[model samples]
Target: MSLHADAWSTLASWRPDYYTQEALRQAFLGYLAARPDACQRSCAAGHITASALVFDAGGEHLLLTLHPRVGKWVQLGGHCEPSDSTLAGAALREATEESGIADLRIDPVPVHVDVHPITCSLGVPTRHFDVRFAVRAPRGAHPVRSAESLDLRWWPVDALPDEDGELDMMLAVLR
Candidate 1:
């Protein structure tokens, strides 16, 4: 199946744990039904993005990157690629690329979804329909900071600088 179809099927079959998440899932399905090119960045209105919240081997620390463009600490992820076959795969790929850490294990199930506006590489403002997943880092994992980020570090989950509580929300739904 196509990546777009995989996204639709995934969301359609997922049973969100919260009412808010259910609403987001419905919104994603509706958006996908209306826009065939919704997974592509060229959609102009918005596009699907895959991201991962990386947990340490022991699950105490969460890896985050200070995005150079947004200048805010955010999870590792980006726009979906044509080569991606599944949303989980796209998210895992992004996490590996941004964190520079291999052998990360993805949950396959979505942990969260968000919509936000940004002027990305397209040079115009657009909304990002973000699909988030949980990923586990290997033991003694050493992260290499990518040029895409201003800084990369593992922050204690309890003391995260998540101003919007996005990270907390992602973690909360899992438990």
Candidate 2:
């Protein structure tokens, strides 16, 4: 099926009150509809995963990863495995594995839900239904990078690497 069709299907499964979710869904659908070959395969049917935009207790900094694939700084997240019963569980797992921080805790509420299409290093396209949660880490918690990231650091929320539009969007959400 087309990416637009897949986005619509995914959006329909989510709660409609979330403006970010709807907006992202529409944006992705529009992009896909405009470019049928944007992605190698439609990820509309893939299992959704959770992610954390973790900030220190001071809230002045946010944990970010320089992704091994995209080579962009982003929140901690990955695919949902069959063992993960909930999106939050999958996100927490990815966060701990990638960042090597065991004390991270997500707030009870979700910060945002975003659905976006990404092209892998091989130029294969896939969709990610990222349920973003807000989290607070203990002061002075150091991050250790895993294979998924080239580097991991806590960046000041006000100062982020200047790059693509996607980074700006993510920063806005993180802010």
Candidate 3:
């Protein structure tokens, strides 16, 4: 099946835990149906972005990136690339790229979905239909900071930033 078809199937099969999540899932499906280039960065209307909450081997620490533009410690993820064939693959690629850790293992099942506004590099405001999954780092994995982030660090899952509701929600589902 095509990547676009695969994405639709993934979202269709997901059972969200909250009303908002279900709404987002439906909205994403609708967006995909309406826009053939939903996964492309130039999709202007809106695009599907993939992200992953990466945990260390012990599962005690989560790798977060200090996003330069948003100025928030967020998960490793970004726009879907043309080479990506699946949402899970996009999320894993983002995790590996942003964290500079190539040995990460991503769970194919998404843990959460969120829709939020973002200013694209082209200076256009667009919504990102974010699909989030859980990914695991290799044992003794040490992360290097990539150019995409101002800094990269591992945080205790319980002590995540209070303002990051997305992280909180993800942790709630993961735990």
| Candidate 2 lDDT (Cα, 0 to 1) | 0.65
Best by lDDT: 1
Of 2 and 3, which scores higher on lDDT? 3
In candidate 2, position 45 carries an lDDT of 37
Per-prediction tally of clashes: 0, 0, 0
TM-score between model 2 and native: 0.69
Instruction: Sort the predicted structures by TM-score, highest score first.
Output: 1, 3, 2
At residue 139, what lDDT does model 2 achieve?
A: 76
For model 1, give the 10-residue run with minimal summed lDDT.
166-175
Assess the local accuracy of residue 61 in candidate 1 as a C-alpha lDDT between 0 and 100. 94
**Better model by lDDT, 1 or 2?**
1
Winning candidate number (TM-score): 1
lDDT of 1 by residue, 32-65 (tens): 9999999998999999999999999999999999
Name the Cα RMSD for model 1.
Answer: 0.9
RMSD of each: 0.9, 6.4, 1.1
lDDT (tens digit, per residue) of candidate 2 on 37-79: 4333334433245688878879888889988777788888876
